[model samples]
Target: MVTLGVDGLVSGLDTTSIITNLMSVEAQPQTLLKSQLSATQAKATAYRTVNTRFDAIRSAAEALTSTSLAAARSASSTNSTVTASATSSAVDGSSVSFRVEQLATAKQVTSLEKWSSPTARADEQPKPVWPIKVLDSTGATVGSIVIPANATLTDAVSAINASGYGVHATIVQLAANQFRLQVSSDGTGTDGARTLQGADETADDPQSQTVGTAESGFQRSRDAVNAQISIDGTGYVRESSTNTFADLMTGVSVTVSKADPTATSPTTISVGVDGSAIAAKVKALVDAANGALGVIKGYTVSTAGSAVATLQGDRALVQLGDSVMDAVSSAIGGKSLSTLGLQLNKDGTLSFDSGKFTATLASDPTTVNRLLSGVPATTTDGVTTAAVPGFADKIAALAKAASNSSTGTLVQLANGRDTLANAIQDKIDGWDIRLANRKDTLTKQFTALETALSTIKNQASWLSSQINQLYNPNKSS
Candidate 1:
């Protein structure tokens, strides 16, 4: 992309200035193209800004229609020992109490006699045969591990660990060189109790690994026990394999951490709807509406003596704020939005009164939810009417229509502006090439003229010299 603008060589003319002026005149169309591109880009940016606000409004408005907000609930316990949680299906005003009688216990046991070596040595023990079987409380063989024959205590621990049917075993050191086998259940339930079936032992046989039943002299450290709880001071007891009780009440889960066998004073449990949460969501919608209106005003509003805006007099964006206002300003079930603490201001923005809204929600929560979303069909007097959409529904649909990526009005408008800007830039680029070519042609023409003029001047000087020499030749002779 080289360019040349040379001065006159022989004609003494300013070729550079001449070519520059001509190119300036020829580039007028490109100047106009650049101006158009800048305008189109500004308009596209304005559209994107408005579209972003519209999307935010859509999200906030749609949130008010969520069922979770309509009946959002929370649960609490009076005592830390008894914690509770409520689900979506939980009733709003249900209260229940439970007295934890006993906590579930896992089966734990230890061998009575210490393992000792057959050499009567102080620091060794006899190794047992392979495949020691373990049985649960119901006498069902849970697992059998074929460990290496003549296994060590650690090897025996590994063998018991390999028996993966809810049994874990470890070696306990009671004193110097005095070790015993301790086995515990992995789960807390009466059904999870385990018995280590091993070689029988007699007093005469010190090395015989007798690890069967209590007859084999084993101490039960803790028995596998079920959790027990009484409901509302009832004498009847409810048993559970685990501490967590999910079926005690509808949509309620209670987990007990301590036991109070005497049902004297029980922990209180309460469940209720979240009023503040609902109010906050409503406030969010109002704030989002305000934001959208603010963006629109910034783009459309102009004072009497102020400069024009990028999107001034834009009908689509001008009507956007009004449309959203109209969608949300309508009454719900014969009640105006003012009653719900969402007010339309004189400047066409939304203002929220959180205190008043929360008060209204506290008094008539059902109506509040209905105003935000919509209620089911109702028959009044004698006419049956279908369900009516509410402010949230209307605003959500409107904002979605204006901001949806595939078919949104502002999105497509911005895209069109971008396309037009790109086309204008293309034309400007073409004009640039044309102007450069024109400058190069002018420079070549000037250079060629300078060469021709120099040749004619040389020929004229030679002719004058020849005439002088010929005329003065006789005089010289």
Candidate 2:
């Protein structure tokens, strides 16, 4: 329907205002839908907010379960370049010193002869040559690179690199137009060494490329050498193919980046128990638990002031907060959470006593660890016992179940609310079209009424004039 531009042409009434007021009443349903959409969107956002805190709790709990946290050893080296890491198996308060004998190196060789151009020329034209055979130290063929059509130094480099046989080839330009082929093993030590060989004196044949020549034809630039370090004040020495020496001590990984054979300086490594670091992890768990609980409380509880609790009347969300608190306050192995410096406050939030935790950890670390991580149930002779979930593990399980991406309860709740909000928005959008059409129809009806009124007024005026003329036709003055 089209709208009439005229507003009450003869009725002398404000038709546009009337139509607007009528449309306002007609849009009651849409008004209600808009309210519903806002509330539903808020609910979705609140659910995700709670889920975010729950995810944080899950991460902190998982950190507690890690071996890295349990072992909690700190290692340092006197030399700044060398780095060492200690695993759970490493003994606390252990120290070791070692002298760097030499660093690991790869086997490298260069072409004995220089070439005028990178590409080979036969009969004054580019030609193909035999492939460069890469033989291991034991003379076993490990890799081979064939010369491409119109072979050039770039071709050889690409072929050797793409072969993926753990070797790198480069064309070294000693000077402009004086290029030589340089090949090196990608790996260090004797085990990674390879010997390059080409056709033996086949210059007259089609394979006349003397670039990567036969064995003994190339200059041995560098030999594959292993990394060696001597134990301080002891004759015992260790060697590794790579820069890392993982077995020098139990649970200790040592990596040497620099070595000075003639220097008397020795790198001293000390591994010590990191009690403070472990305590910090427990504190993080407590903080995360408190954070999740606070979010839950804010959403579920109403206050004296006028902040609306979006989820105040929700029963499930209330239960979620209660479950998290229970997970924190519950006992493990008949031991209260205070044993780990975790205490529940009156306001339903968790508090961490770091000093108490550190003391407990120092007194009995093994038992403390068990309380954080649950004990698996043992079965014998058809008898089964339930496993006891420890504090961290239990909280982790609950939070994970509530915050997991695919199946978390809170995740699904938020997703469901979002779906509902989307549907409500669709209804609201539909009203925009309906209201426009209704206004057009109302305006057209008023325009038609004005046209009919104008015709009636003209007819009435004509009738009065004709009656007067008939009554006084001969009495004109």
- lDDT (Cα atoms) of all candidates against the true structure: 0.77, 0.81
Instruction: Give candidate 1's root-mean-square deviation (CA, Å).
Output: 7.3
Best by TM-score: 1
Question: In model 2, which runs have C-alpha deviations exceeding 4 angstroms?
Answer: 59-102, 110-186, 198-215, 228-239, 246-253, 257-291, 297-309, 312-315, 322-326, 329-363, 375-388, 400-441, 471-477
Error of 2 at 319 (Å): 4.5
Clashes of each: 0, 0
Candidate 1 ranges beyond 4 A from true positions: 1-7, 11-21, 66-70, 102-228, 233-244, 302-308, 327-330, 345-348, 375-382, 386-388, 460-477
lDDT of 1 by residue, 1-477 (tens): 333344766788887788778888888888988988999999999999999999988998877885756457767788888888877788878887778889888988876767653223212433232345666676666777665544566776776787688889887887876778788988886866666665442222224754333225467899889888877756777887788888566788888889986756787788877667777888888888888888888888786888778888899997788888887678878888888888788878788888998898778887787778887688999888888788888899889989999899899989999999999989988888888888778777777887899899899999998998889857666
- Candidate 1 accuracy as TM-score: 0.69
Deviation in angstroms for 217 in model 1?
14
Q: Residue by residue across 1-477, what tens digits does model 2's lDDT show? A: 767687877778788899899999999999999999999999999999999999999999988884755578877789987899888788888989988888899999887666667674311222223566777755567877776566667677778889887789888889877877788998898878877766442221225533333555568899999999988889788999889998578888899998866666778999876778888998888888888888887888889876879898688778888887887778888888888888888988888888988888878887788788877787989898888888888899989999999999999999999999999999999999999889989888888888888888889899998998889868667
